[model samples]
Target: MSRRGWVLFLAMSVIWGIPYLLIKVAVDEVSPETLVFLRCLIGAALLLPWTIARGQLRPVLRHWKALLLFTVLEMAGPWFLIAYAEQTLSSSLTGLLVAGVPFVAALAALLLGEEERLTPVRLLGMAIGVVGIGVLLGLDVDGAQLLPLLAIGLVLVGYATGPLVVTRALPDVPGTAASSIALFVTAVVYTPFALPQLDGTGQVSAPAWWSLAALGVLCTAIGLALFFALIREVGPQRALVITFVNPAVAVLLGVWLLGEPFTLGIALGLPLVLVGCVLATRRSPARTEPSELADVDSAVP
Candidate 1:
C-alpha cells in the first residue's frame, strides 16, 4: 500500500469504528427505527446527488428487487438490530460481536453454492468461532442479555447475506448508487415509524445529533466511497483487512469515550472469533481471491 492507501485505510478504520459509539449515543434519545431512518436520509441526501451527477444512479433502479433485498438485509435490518443491541450491549461488545461477519459470510457463501470446500482448517475455525459465541453467551446466560445476543446473531446473518445479494443480483450497479438507493429506500420504509419518534427530537442532546450526522455522512456515505477506493488502491485482499481493524477501534472508542465495560467474556471471545474469521474466509493456496470482493460493499456499522 502507498502512503495515500494507508491514510484512507486508517481514516476508514476510524470512520467505520465510530458508528458503534454514535449509534449508542443516538439510540439513547431516538428510537432505533428513527435513528436508522434519519441516518439513511442524510446519507442518501449526501450521496444520491453525486451518484446522479455521475450518471450511475439509473442502473441501481434496474435491479430493484435485488436492491430491495440488499436494503433489507444490509442497511435496514442490521442497522436497526445493531441500534437495538447497543441499547443493552456495550458499544465495545457490539463491535466485537460484529467482527464475526466474515465467518458468517463464509458459511453463507458455501451454503449459497459458492464452490469453496469446507476444509479441516476452515471447519476448525468455524468451531472456534462458535465457541467464542458460546463464551459470549455464557457470560450473560442467566441475564437479560440473551435476546440482545440473538439480535446480534440476526444482524450477523443479515450482514453475511448482503454481499451475496449484491454479487448475484446487482453486480453491475455502481457502489455509490447502490449505497444511496438502498439508504433512500430504507429511509422511506421507516419514515412512518420514524416520524412519530421525531416528536421528541427537541429533547435530544447535541452529542446525539452530531453522532447521527457522523453516522450518516461519515459512516454510511464516505465510508462506502473510501472502502471502494481502498480496494482500488491496495487490492481487495488488503482492503478486507479493514474488517479486522474496525472492531479494535470500536472497542477502544467505546472504552475510552463511552466508558463501556470490557468484560471477561469479550476479552476471551474477541480473539477466538477474529482468528476464526480469518481462517474461515481465507483463500486456499491454490485458490485466487474473488474479484467480486471489490464489487460488493460490505461496510458495517
Candidate 2:
C-alpha cells in the first residue's frame, strides 16, 4: 500500500470503528429506527449533492432493485440490529461480533456459488471463528442477554450478504452514488417508524446528539467514500485488512470513552476472530474468483 492507501486505511479503520460506540451512545436516547433514520438522513444530506454533481445518481438509480437490496442488507437491517444490540451488548463486544463479518462473508460466498472451492485453511479459520463466538457467548454473555446475540447474528448475516448483492448485482455502479442512494432509501423506509419517535428525540442528551452527528457524517458518508477509495487503492483483499483494525479502535474507545467493560472473553475471543478473519480472507494461491475480494469489500458499509 502506498502512503495514500495507508492514509485511507488508517482513516477508515477509525471511521468505521467509531460507529459502534456512537450507536451505543445514540441508541441511549432514541429508538433504533429513529437512530438509523437520523444516520441515513444525515449521511444522505452530505452525499446526495456530491453524487448528483458527479452525474452518478442516474446510473445508480438504473439498478434500483439491487440498490434496494443493498440498502436493506447493507444499511437497513444491520444498522438497526447493531444499534438494537448495542442497547445491551458492550460496544467492544458489538465490534468484536461484527468483526466476524469476514468469516460470514466467506460462508456467504460459498453458499452463493461465488466460491466453489473452500480451502481447508479457510474452513479451519471459519471453525475457529465459530469457537470464538461460542467462547464469547458461553463465558461472557448471560442467558438473559441472548437477544442481543440474536440481533448480532442478524447483523452478521446482513453484513455478509450485502456485499455479495452489491458485487454481483451492481458491480459497475459507482460506490458513492450507490451508498448515497441507499442511505436515502433507508431514510425513507424508516421514516414511518421514526416519525413517532421524533417528538421525543428533543430530550436526547448532548453527547448522544454529537455521537449521532458523527455516526451520520463521519462514519456513514465520509467513511463510505474512504472505504471505496481504499478498495480501489489497495484492492479488496489487502483493503479488507482494515477490518482487523476496527475492533481494536472500537474496544479502545469503548473502554476509554464509554468506560465499557473489557473482559477475558474479549481478550481471548477477539484475537481468535481477528485471526480467523485474516485466514478466511487471505488470498488463496490458486484462487480463480476475481471478484471475491470485491464482494467482501463492497459490503464494508
Candidate 3:
C-alpha cells in the first residue's frame, strides 16, 4: 500500500471503530429507527453536495433500483438491528459478532459462483474462526442476552450481504456514488418511523447529537469514501483486514469509554475470531484480484 492507502486504511479503521461507541451513546436516548434515520439523513446531506458537484447525482438517480436494494440491505436494516441489539449487547460483543462477515461473504461468493474458490485451508480457517467465536460466546454468554445475540446474527447476515450486493448488483456504479445514493434512499425509507420520534422531548443530548454528527460526517461519509478508495486500491479481500482491527477498537472503547467489562473470554475469543477471518479469507499465492468493496459493511453497532 502507498502512503495514501495507509492513511485511508488507518482512518477507516479508527473512524469505523468509533461508530459502535457513538451508536451506544446516541441510542441511550434515541430509538434505533430514529438513529438510523438521522444517520442516513445527515450522511446524505453531507454527501449530496459532493455527488452533485461531481455530477454523479443524476447517474445515481437513474440507477434507483440498485440504490434501493443497497440502501435497505446495507444501511437501514443493519443500522437499526445493531442499535436494537446494543440495547442488550456490549459494543465489543457486537463487534466480535461482526467479525464473521468475511466468512459469510466468502460463503456467499462460493454459493453465488463468484471468482473465489473455497479450499480446504480456507475451510479449516473458517472452522477455527467459528470455534473462536464459540469460545468468546461461552465466556461472554453470561453477559449476553438472547435477543441481543439474535440481533448480532442479523447484523452478520447484513454485513455478509454487503459485498455480494456491491459486487453483483451495483458493480458498475462507483462505490462513493453507490454509497451516497444508498444513504439517501435509506433516509427516505426511514422517514415514516423516524418522523414520529423526532418530537422535542425525543431530541438527543449534545454529546449524543455530536456522536450522531460524527456518525454521519466522519463515520458514514468520510469512512465510506476511504473504504471505497481502499477497495479500489488494495482490493476487497485485503481491505477486509480492517474488520480484524475494528473489533479491538470496539472492545477498547466498550471497556474504557462505556465501562463495559472486558473479560478473559473476549481476550481469548477476539484473536480466535480474527485468526479465523485471516485463514478463511487469506489470498492464495495464485489469487490476484482483490474484492471491490473491502467488506467494511460490518459497521454494526
Candidate 4:
C-alpha cells in the first residue's frame, strides 16, 4: 500500500468505526427498524444517480434473485440486527464483536472448501476471541439483555456470510452496483415496518437528523466507496486488516464522545480480541490464493 492507500485505509477505519456511536445516538430517538429504513433509503438515494449513470441498473435488475439474496443477508438482516443490538449494547462492544468477522469468514471459507486447511493457531485464536466475547458479555450492565447480544452475534454471522455469497454467487457484479441495489432492496423491505413508527406526533431534534444523515451518507455511501477502493489497491486479506483499527476508534469514541464507561473487562478482553484478529488474519505462504470471498467479508459492512 502506498501513502495514499494507507491514508484511505485509516480514513475508512475511522469512518466505519464512528457509525456505531452515531447509531447508538440515533437509535435513542428512533426505533431500530426506523433507523435501518431511513439509513438504507438515504444511502440508496445518494447512490442512485451514480448507479444509474454507470448503467448497472439493467444488469442488477436482470439478476434480481441474486441481488435479493445479497440484500437480505448483507443489508437487511445484519443492519437491523446491529441496530437493534446497539439499543442496549454499547457501540464499542458492538465494534469489538464485529472484530470476530474475519475469523468467521475464515471458518466459512474452510467449511466451503475455498481455502487451505485451518491450522491450530487459527483455531486457538478463534477460541480466544470467543472467550474474549464471553468476557465482554459477562460484563454487560444488563444481564437479562443476553438475547440482544446473541442477536448481535447472529448479525456478525450474517455479515461474515455475506462475502461468501458475493464471491460464490455474484462474483461478476460490480461492487458499487451490487451494494447500491442491496441498500435499495433493504430500504424497500424495511419501509413498511419503519413507516408505522413515524407518527406525526413529535419532531426529532436537529442533531438526531444530522446523525442519521451522517450515518447514511458518510458511513454507508462514502465508507463503502473507500472500502472498495482499498480492496482494489490491496488484496482483500490485507484490506480486511482495517477491522483491527475500527474497534479502537469505536472504543475511543464511545468513551470520549458518548462518555461510555470503560471497565477492567474491556481493558483485559480487548487485547485478547486484537491478538486473535491478528492471528487469524496473518498471511501465510500456504494460503497463497488471494481470496475473493475474503475480500467480500472484509468489505461486507
Which model scores highest in lDDT? 2
**Considering TM-score, which of the candidate structures 1 and 3 is the better prediction for this target?**
1
lDDT of 3 by residue, 89-195 (tens): 78888877778787776787778886467888899889988888898788787654888787778777776776666666665666787777788888898899989
Instruction: Give candidate 1's error at residue 213 in angstroms.
Output: 1.0
C-alpha TM-score for every candidate: 0.94, 0.95, 0.92, 0.93
Best by TM-score: 2
User: Candidate order by TM-score, highest to lowest?
Assistant: 2, 1, 4, 3
Model 3 score (lDDT): 0.78
Give residue 155's error in model 1 in angstroms: 0.7
True-vs-predicted CA distance for residue 101, candidate 4, Å: 1.5
Clashing pairs in 1: none
lDDT of 1 by residue, 1-301 (tens): 7999999899988898889999999899899999999999999998889889988877668889988998898889999999999898889888888888887888888888964788888888888988886797787344788788889999989988888887787766666678888889999999999998788899999999999999998998898888777777887677777787788888889989988777788788878877887776666678654453333334568
Better of 2 and 4 by TM-score: 2
Q: Which regions of candidate 1 are displaced past 4 Å? A: 140-142, 285-299
Candidate 4 lDDT over residue span 1-301, tens digit each:
7987898888888998888889888888888899999999988998877889999889868778877877877789988888888888888888888777878878887898765676788888888887887787777546677777788778778877777776666777777777888888889989899898889316777777888999999999888778878777776777777888888888889989999888766887788888888777665665554443334455344
The residue-level lDDT of candidate 1 at 11 comes to 92
**True-structure lDDT of candidate 1:** 0.82
lDDT of each: 0.82, 0.83, 0.78, 0.79
Q: Rank the candidates by lDDT, best first.
A: 2, 1, 4, 3
Each model's backbone clash number: 0, 0, 1, 0
Report the C-alpha displacement of residue 37, candidate 3, in angstroms.
0.8
Candidate 2 — which residues are off by over 4 angstroms?
286-293, 297-301
lDDT of 4 at 136: 78
Candidate 3 lowest-lDDT run of ten = 292-301
* lDDT per residue (tens digit) for residues 64-156 in model 2: 998898788888998888888989888988888888887888888888897657788888888888898778887789988888999888888
